[model samples]
Target: MTYTTEIIINKPRKEIIKTFEDSSLFPHWQRGLKRSRVISGKAGEEGSKRRLYINIEGQSIKMTETIIKKNLPEEWHGQYTSKGMKSIQKNYFEALDDHKTKWTSQSEFEFSGFMKLISKLLPDMFKKRSVMVQQDFKTFIEEGKPVKTN
Candidate 1:
């Protein structure tokens, strides 16, 4: 399944990038994300690994993400492996102006073996999952000003 989501933040490019790069900061804004841990290398650098545990379908799945590109204040790309499923995510953040940033995520993956058949039959399910995840981010960025996500 290919899933993607996007949002425009009202924060500066640097501030937004800081929030994205901070592994300990994910649970605060990332919806359904239980936690994130740095697996091996330093974050914001190529080859950094982050282990993410997320809730999906009332279940939890562990995902390991390897940084493919980590250009801060602009873009980040990574490949994720979760439960024998592999996918790649390209996250782009563009500064629309001094006070606005556009955040976009594009992911592509193939579900084979048995899952592929299900994905082919029910595309909306996967898309909805992606939408919910992004909506969490949107809520965090939009609401973090006055309150804490945690």
Candidate 2:
């Protein structure tokens, strides 16, 4: 499955990129994200790997993310792998004006085992989740709202 999601952030591209590059700020916008730790190479750089722990509903999920490309304020790409699914995410950033920035996320997912069935049955779920994450980031950047988790 492949889909694209986008949002316009009410901030300069440079400001948005600065915040986006800071791994420490991820949990504030990324819902259900518990923690992340670098596993190999340099964090955020090409070839770096990080393990992410997240909670969805009541289930704990873990995924490994490897940076594929990092061209800040323009584009970045990453590969994420979990138990039964893998995704390639390409992100593009554009400056719409002096105060507005556009963030576009293109994602392609490959599924195996049960995840394949789930993907077929609910393909829209993935795109919806991606949009929600983008909106969460916009809220965090514009209004200082962090995703609330229990």
Candidate 3:
């Protein structure tokens, strides 16, 4: 199954792109992400790996993401692996105007067994997750303040 989500940020395309290219700030924009660390090299290089712990309800899941494609200020694609399940995530950015940016994120996963059954009920699980993350980023960029985490 694939999940996609989009948002318009009231910031220049460069600022929005910086949030994605600079992995050091992932925690500030991603609410579900509990922690992340680079494996291969620095933030913006291809083949760089990031292991993220995401909060799923009251529990946490560990997912390792490897960069597959990189086109700065344009596109980024990665593969996420969690519990032996692999998924592809794609992110794109477009300038809506001088100070506006449109961002879209897509993901496709091969789910099975219990997950397949659950996904049927939760139609927009990843979409919601993406939206939540983007909304936080919107706050970070527009307000110069991140969403408070407690």
Tell me each candidate's TM-score: 0.83, 0.97, 0.88
* Preferred candidate (lDDT higher): 1 or 2: 2
Clashing pairs in 2: none
Residue-wise C-alpha lDDT for candidate 1, range 38-149, written one tens digit per residue: 8888865799898989886687989998999877767889998876478888988988999888888898886766667767787687667666656666666667631144
Q: What is the lDDT of residue 35 in candidate 3?
A: 78
lDDT of 2: 0.93
Scored by lDDT, model 1 comes in at 0.76
Q: Which whole-number lDDT from 0 to 100 does residue 9 have in model 2?
A: 94
Tens digits of per-residue lDDT, candidate 3, 7-98, equal 99988899888776766677777776777888776665789888889887886889988999999688989898877367898989999999
- In order, the Cα lDDT scores of the candidates are 0.76, 0.93, 0.81
TM-score of candidate 3 against the unseen true structure: 0.88
Residue ranges of candidate 1 with Cα displaced over 4 Å:
1-4, 145-150
Better of 1 and 3 by lDDT: 3
Name the runs in model 2 displaced over 4 angstroms.
none
On the 0 to 100 scale, the lDDT of residue 146 in model 1 is: 15
State which candidate, 1 or 2, has the greater TM-score.
2
